[model samples]
Every structure is written in C-alpha cells, then in structure tokens.
Target: MSIVSSEKNRCIVLVGMPGSGKTTVGRDLAKRLGLRFVDTDHEIEARTGVKIPIIFEIEGEDGFRKRETQTLDDLTRESNMVLATGGGAVIRPENRALLRERAVVVFLSVPPPILWERTRHDRSRPLLQVSDPRGRLEELLKVRGPYYREVAHIIVEGGRGTPHAMVKLIEKELQALCEH
Candidate 1:
C-alpha cells in the first residue's frame, strides 16, 4: 500500500535534538511543498514575547515544556505545514499524542557526536549547557530515541548536506510515499 495521495492533507513534523537541522530543513521543505513553515521554539518565543533561553531561565524546563506543549497543540490544528519541534518536545506524552494524531512525524536522525560538534558552541540550548553535554546527549538520545521512533512515520538521516539538499531528499521520499 502507498501512502502518497493520503499524505496530502497531512502536516510534516520534524523531531530531533538541537542542531539536528530541523528548522533549516523545515523551512526548505515548506518552500518546496509550497506549505507554511513553523518552528515551535520560535512560536513559543513569539507568543510569550521572550526567547527560549529566557523561558528556561525564568520558568525552567518544566515551564518551558508547558508552553511547548501548548504551541504544539495549536500548530497541529492546522494542515499542510512543516513544523520543527524543540528537541524536548517528544518527552511529553501529550505532545507525542498530538504529533501522532495530527501529523506525519519524521525523525531527522543525527548521531550524538555530530550533535555535540554542531551544538558545542551554542549556549542557547538549556540542556546542553552542562559540563558534560556530550554525555548527557548520549544518555538523552538513548532514552528519547524510542519515543522519536515511535512517533515517526519516517526517519531521515541528516547527513552533512545543505538544507536545500535535505529538503530535496525529504521531498523525494514524500513524493514516493504519495505516489503509491
């Protein structure tokens, strides 16, 4: 059975750790598909009138998560969009439920080593600010990998390519799925 035509109304939800290229790929994917693009982190920041780092600083992870969950709920209510969720968004069961219910989740899989290299200098990620961020990322990946896989209808290995290339790859896969 092919999922191609049935995927027309579906939203594409990108899930991955920080620096996994979710935002970049989502923007490209949306453009390629002529759909709207939304990043949950940006949406949270916009709605709250504060940055994600500030949210983490003020409300902590739990508080930021509440906002993330709400944003995910609102974004999923629409169709034909590419949504890039924050890395921790899948940690909550409700967020997962909303993602599974409203979108075709895709895991932009990145190895822990690559993630460390990409995010090492980035101070914006609250969780990655720890001393042993790589170790923490490894542990987190081990725990969250299953959740990501569970929610994802597809998995795309995010290699060392430009966002446009990644978009093309994703579009190929999506078009293939749609054709059947």
Candidate 2:
C-alpha cells in the first residue's frame, strides 16, 4: 500500500482502461514528483510518425500491440519516470510481468459508464469503432479487470476529479509509502 518498499526503481507506471486519464494524470503526477513523464501511446505515435488510429488502421490491433509491448519494455527500464501505458497493455503476460517487476504499477479505475461518457465521441479510439462502443468497453473491462488487478500495486479511483486533483491523491498515496 505504500510507495516505499523493497523496490529500488523509481519508475511509476499508470495502467487502466482507455478513458481513465492515464496520460493526463501521469503527466501531472510526474511534474509533481519531479520525474520524467512518458505516455506509451504517444511514444508509439512518435516512433511511427502516425496517430494511433492510423496505426490501428494500417497494422491492426495485433501489430499495434506488438509495438506497445516493445515500448513498454523500453520505458520500464528507465529510472525516475512516470509512464502512462496503453489500455490493453495488461493483456500480455510479458507486459504485466515487466510492469510489476520494474516499477510501481497504478491502475486508474473508472466506471464503465464514466468511461463511455469520456470516450463516446472520440474517434481516435480504435477499439470503440464498434456498433456499440459502450458494449465493447464493458466487454473489455470484464476480460481485463483481473489482469489489471494482478499487476497493479495500487488502484486509484479516476473519476470526478481534475487531473491536478487526481495527482494530489496519488501524491498522498506515494507520500504515505515514503513516510513508512
């Protein structure tokens, strides 16, 4: 429950569903903590020189996932960084292991309804292109919930708060660990 522990690495990884505000909160959290901030999805886009939706269109989810895993592997190795991971990063066992072993993994949990509200009009989410995006989100949550829990060292409620407020809550949690 504490951020301080036997783990020596200073990396903090944020994991969760697509609309959980990982990138926003992670950036603020990193700034508050004075660590580098990196969003895996953005890293992927930067490397490929295309938006994620474009990558999904060209390479399919499988190819994008391969790239995600590679990026996650590389980012987790760095010290003093806050990394916002892709939503489905926990689907792969290797990614889960790397996240758990190399850094403090925090799951930003938001209810499905809230997630839908946040992402409904976002065309960039490749997975939500279905006839019923809410249905897809619910389905993904059902399958991925356990993996998220399995890899998370902490679970933070990610709803009804500004990114700065969420960062404050996370900072409190991390500070509690440090105090111990």
Candidate 3:
C-alpha cells in the first residue's frame, strides 16, 4: 500500500546530520507520496526574512534552536507532509519527545567522512563554518546519535544510495511499520 494511504493526519519526518540527504530525500518522498514538503531551516529563513547564518550572527545557536522548536511544534501539527529537520533539531529533549510523538521519524544515518565530503564546500551550514569542520561533524554525530535513534522509528543508511533509493527504502520500512 501507499505510505500515506493508512492515515490522513500522519507526517513523515526526516532527521539526520547535514548533507545526509534529508532535504533531497524528503522532497522526493513528498512528491512521490503526493504530500507537501517542509524543510525546517528553510521555514525559519522564510519566517524571519533572513538567512540562517545571519540568524546565527544575531540570535545565536540558542536562538536558532528556539525558532526550530517553535517551527517543529507548528509543522508537526500539519498532515500529509514530509518534514526535513536541521541536524541539531534532536539536541533538545523536548524536540526529541515531540518528534517521537508527532510523526513517523526516520533517521538517515551517514558516516562522518561522507558527510564531510558532501558538506565541505557548502558555506550555508552554520555549524560547519568552523576551522575544523570534519572534527565538528564527528563530534556532533557522536553527541547526537543517541538522540536521533531515540526519536526515530526507523533508521536508514543514507550515503550509499541515491535519494530515490533512500526514499524507496523508507517507503518499504513505512509500509512494514504500517502492517504491524
């Protein structure tokens, strides 16, 4: 059966490190499932009329996280959508609790090396702007891994396949989950 056929009010949430293909996979999954797509980072930028880096420069990571939590609260209430969250969204216990309760969460697990390769040239990620970005990615992964696992109903390896393939795997897992 189609992933969305089971419930009208359900949402598919994509959580992972930056460059783990959450946004790309989410867009594909949403289109294939005929659902709306929302990226929390983009939503924040849209709402605040500023880029994330600018937000970081002004309100700082703490502030950005506050916006993220608020956005997650609002977006998780919507149905028929695929939501791609920021890498650090799982950093807070409250965010983890809400994600676990509000949607069928998928954690895209990609190794730090691959994530570094994918994100090395991207200047948009506020966290990766440090002098040793690879080290930061690894550290972030180590700290956040448990949180992602805690919040996710499914964990899918992300770096080995195309976004479409990942979506197919996610769809298979979602179908299996629905059956149980």
TM per prediction? 0.92, 0.93, 0.96
Comparing 2 with 3 on TM-score, the higher-scoring candidate is 3
Model 1 residue 2 CA deviation (Å) reads 14
Q: List the residue pairs that clash in candidate 1.
A: 2-180, 4-177, 4-178
Which sequence of candidate numbers ranks them by TM-score, best first?
Answer: 3, 2, 1
> Mind giving the per-residue lDDT tens digits that candidate 1 earns over 54-123?
8899999999999899899888888778999999899999998999888888899998888889888988
Error of 2 at 81 (Å): 0.8
Ordered from best to worst lDDT, the candidate numbers read 3, 2, 1
Q: Which of 1 and 2 is the better model by TM-score?
A: 2
Best by TM-score: 3
Q: Give the higher-lDDT candidate: 2 or 3.
A: 3
Candidate 3 local lDDT, 4-24, one digit each (tens): 555532799999999999999
- Give lDDT: candidate 1, residue 37: 94
55-156 in candidate 2: lDDT tens per residue? 998999999999999999888878888999989999999999999899888899999999999999999899999999999999999988999999987888
lDDT of each: 0.85, 0.88, 0.92
